[model samples]
Target: MATKTDDPKVLAQNRKANHDYFIEDTVEAGIVLTGTEIKSIRQGKANLRDSFVRIQSGEAWLINCHISHFEHGNRFNVDPTRTRKLLLHRTQIDKLFGQMKEKSYALVPLKIYLKNGFAKVLLGLAKGKKNYDKRQDVAKKDAQRDIDRALRDRQKY
Candidate 1:
């Protein structure tokens, strides 16, 4: 048996959000998780696609994230895609709410990682990228890859 550090944990990730949004800033927040939920997460059975954050009544919540129930979890298992609450300070919530009011800023979950035996969600304040911006980013990545390939090839000479 491995320790928590070696625990196969990674509940969910939002890969599409990264592709569609330009991540401006990120914040790590604690998630309200249940026993069975934790088991499922440790098994890597969660999805963060289509999830978004909404602040209401001075609290932040994550919506549309799907954390599948553990197979042997029985009746105690909760819904997979339940709206989960996020733990954050009031000032941070207020600041995020203000930024969300802007037309471009959107809330996105970057990754889920286990820290100190607790589950943590890495959230991002993102701005949607225009089509051209995405194309330019792709082109830049391609160019960088080419440069790396060229340098590696040079090393062989």
Candidate 2:
């Protein structure tokens, strides 16, 4: 019973991606989906939490993404964790392949959304963050929050 909106509606997001990696760039890519899969996504039954993008044989594939089976799909239901192909321009794919050659670089799916009634994924070119880097990010966020709080308090005085 999820309501469809005129604006693009996000179906799933990887909230941990930002905390675990430093995203350098992002690209919007189309995903290959079955009828049942699309139906399930429209109902907001999708998870990008543990999903990651991989390039093999010059093609990008989405792995570990979970798109729940449509309750009414019955025999049409596909595996929730099936590997889905991602569609990108030839140039874009080549660029991603080049960047991925570096050991530190990775491709991650940031979120999935409906754009113009078609499903799209926001893919990120990211570098993994170390434990210390994560701690630093947390500290910066806390400091920013404190500054905002002080500004709000000052406005009330």
Candidate 3:
């Protein structure tokens, strides 16, 4: 149950983004949504998995994001997977475009949240991670967990 509070309420997040890519930078941008779309999102029926951001002709668009149909919205319901516009400044879009042209950079949607009664997306400028990198990360995490568990047991004894 989400209540209206000053803090932003996260509606959806891409958990695999951190595992598949190395996020270099993040930018927050407003997302355009229809009546039903907003309602669906407020109910936490949005999915950021496998969704991405694209800058084309100086405009940013969110592609492949899914927002389930609102239960009460009949005729107003639209395509759940429709492309949506992302509002960003021209300078920011140009910066991302230039960086993308230079390397294997990608724009991944990291999170979708509601702030100040508007929908916002946190876009991550990321580079793809190799399989070896993922393995190393997992190994490090396992080691850290083992060490913490050992210390906790020692304190109990």
Candidate 4:
């Protein structure tokens, strides 16, 4: 049995985003998709890597996110890398625009998933991490993994 905290069905995730930036906040926004595009997404053929969100003209847009063309789409398929608009409230757009003005801050797409039969994107308010920060994170993870291994060994004794 899956817990309520578990996600419904994640289509694609930008795992590198967590390592590259400090996510200050997350917002759920709807994505405007064409008919064939949604079909491809439903089949889990989507990629969030290299994708970023931009707030412009009181709206949010998703760039570089790829939803693969449906196998049967034929001539109906659109460009995989086409920019798509993100549906967000005016206030939310305003907030994102404000945060984006700060140095090194960015709007990034963390994950894409289906919710209540609609496609949603998890948008993050992120600040890029320095090279040293990434190295430190790796070292911290390695240390934590070692500690977990030690605990498991002790428990098995």
Candidate 1, residue 54: lDDT: 88
Poorly placed runs, candidate 1 (over 4 Å)? 1-11
Candidate 2 — what's its lDDT? 0.94
Which candidate gets the maximum TM-score versus the true structure?
3
RMSD (CA, Å), candidate 2 to true, equals: 2.7
User: What's model 1's overall lDDT?
Assistant: 0.87
TM-score of each: 0.91, 0.94, 0.95, 0.94
Instruction: Identify the candidate with maximal lDDT.
Output: 3
What residue runs in model 3 are displaced by over 4 Å at the alpha carbon?
1-5
Q: Residues 1-157, candidate 4, lDDT per residue (tens digit)?
A: 5434445578899999999999999999999999999999999999998999877677788999988999999999999999999999998898778778855579999998988778999999999899999999999999999999999999998
The Cα local distance difference test for each model comes to: 0.87, 0.94, 0.95, 0.91
Residue 45, candidate 4: how far off, in angstroms? 0.8
Q: Please estimate how well model 4 matches the true structure, expressed as its whole-model Cα lDDT.
A: 0.91
Error of 2 at 122 (Å): 0.3
Root-mean-square deviation (CA) per prediction: 2.4, 2.7, 2.1, 3.0
**Per-residue lDDT value at 155 in model 4:** 100
Q: Comparing candidate 3 with candidate 4, which one achieves the higher TM-score?
A: 3
